[model samples]
Target: MKPGAVYFMANRKNGAIYTGVTSDLIKRVYQHRNGLVDGFTKDHDCKKLVWFEMFDDLEEARRREVQIKKWKRHWKIKRIEEHNPDWDDLWFDIVK
Candidate 1:
């Protein structure tokens, strides 16, 4: 199976947040940023990669995604802040 990742995207530094799971983090985030995927992220323009974590299996990544998505906003925000204090778009970092 393909490697998997759980990630977060935001509209801006302190804006709407979205959590997702993907077998290809780079490609999936690219699709969100470029509006290639039509859904909440596209509708809200949640393009900034605030955070991400890799997993050896897709199911594990997906389970984490679901759990994170259900978290209280503050908890999720704190989690992201811990990983990305600056809340920077990590796309370039990952792609390069």
Candidate 2:
């Protein structure tokens, strides 16, 4: 099975956030950044790749995605800040 990743996208520091899971993290994030995918992320302009966690398989990533989705806004923010205090766009990291 393909490895998967749970990722967070935000419009800006402390701005709207979108949580998602995918087997291809780089491609998925690319779609979001380019406004290819329609839905919450597009509506909220949550295109900045702020954080992510890779899992051994898609099922594990999906489980983590569900859990994170249930978290309150503040909790999500804390998670992002803990790993990325500046909330820098991680696009370069993934591409390279």
- TM per model? 0.95, 0.96
Error of 2 at 48 (Å): 0.4
lDDT of 1 by residue, 7-94 (tens): 9999998899999999999999999999999999999999999999999999999989889888998998898899899999999999
- Residue 13 lDDT in candidate 1: 80
Candidate 2 lDDT, tens digit per residue, 1-96? 779999999999999999999999999999999999999999999899999999998999999999999999999999999999999999999999
**Which pairs clash in model 1?**
none
* Candidate 2 residue pairs in clash (backbone atoms < 3 Å): none
Q: What TM-score would you give candidate 1 relative to the actual structure?
A: 0.95
- Best candidate (score: lDDT): 2
Off by more than 4 A, model 2: none
Candidate 2 lDDT (Cα, 0 to 1): 0.95
Q: Top model by TM-score, which number?
A: 2
